[model samples]
Target: MDANSFLMGGGGAPTAKFPTPGTVVGGHITEPPQVEQQRDIQSGEKKFWNDGNPMMQLVVTVQTDQRDPAIDEDDGKRRIFVKGQMKNAVADAVRAASAKGLEVGGILRVRYTHDGEQKQRGYSAPKQYEAHYTPAAAAQLQNQPAATAPAAPPAQAYGQVPPGVNPVTGEISAQAPAGLDPQQYAAAQQNPNTAALLHQVPPQPGPQAGGEPPF
Candidate 1:
């Protein structure tokens, strides 16, 4: 079949395969089918910051301001994109730059130029932990003990104990032990399952320099 559209001076391109789920057809008017396999991804991480040093991996989709899908000439292969870079990028440490107004879309940037040089642009999404966070944070969060402070001392008969305090506090307060636990956290991270689940980054086999995943 052939569908004609009055856009970009009008052209009747070849027909597209039946639309799939999560696939938008035109003007944010997503075809009803765009609801299948995409269910598992909660705010899919189209943009991801991998094992440190500012590199990023991302998924992307695109459309014109008129909301027309960029259908390819041949297989109707419209390239969806999630913009990324490792310069003095907003998310210097990771893709979480958007939360702090970092990374263009909080996770990724979307753009197209005259001749692909960015003559046009806009934000695509938030700095999703799912997308823009460093794999390190994932490895770290599992073992890092949820960003807590040192376990406060007992209710000093004299001084007032801090909040989140318990009756008798142990020496190893939630404040992670410097030498051992951090190392253990580092080690636990590279365990394939843990790495995949926590940070969305994979763990590499063989030996690493400091037990860390090069993150």
Candidate 2:
């Protein structure tokens, strides 16, 4: 191994641990969401659902607030594993930000609100969360000089455009991007910001509906 690599802080951020209920994590997202296959811990095999569909998770890394003791990292970096209801929470947060999906430098805060109703007797109740997101541009505006801040763009009406199309050019694509489903493609086209976000990140399988826990 190269000795210089050690000085460069090569290892990635440690996964953020939710030690208890009501824990809150807030930070600026450092990268786009990463989609990875879910694996069984003991068997070390990829996980699948009852219908034979593969399970997946979205990984998001954030530069956390140093004061948040729950993170417990000197570097204030933490990785969040999002699945099931957590995925929906994060996606909803992103949508509320009025930009796209999770974007680099976006502000994200999530709280472990409570446990959900247990669906099965043996399995634990799913962990529920509340998330909020602020777009990078919007966050930066707070610090920008008033005279230098750019004017906001006018909103465009996209309701008439077909799914998987560009409203400005009125161009429709013949097929969805690789890995995106029809529903996702339709949603992406409906919102230009979402389409831009989709272009930046590779398409991944949609989250599965269940009581899977968030880590």
Query: Which is the leading candidate under lDDT?
Result: 2
Looking at candidate 2, the ten consecutive residues that score lowest on lDDT are 152-161
Off by over 4 Å in 1: 1-79, 82-106, 109-145, 148-151, 161-215
How close is every model to the real structure, measured as TM-score?
A: 0.16, 0.57
Tens digits of per-residue lDDT for model 2, 153-173: 533442555555665664544
Model 2 spans > 4 angstroms off:
1-11, 66-73, 143-215
Tens-digit lDDT string for candidate 1 (1-31) = 1122334454333222213322322111111
Clashes of each: 17, 0
Residue 93 of model 2: what lDDT?
A: 90
Superposition-based RMSD of candidate 1 using all C-alpha atoms, in angstroms = 28.0
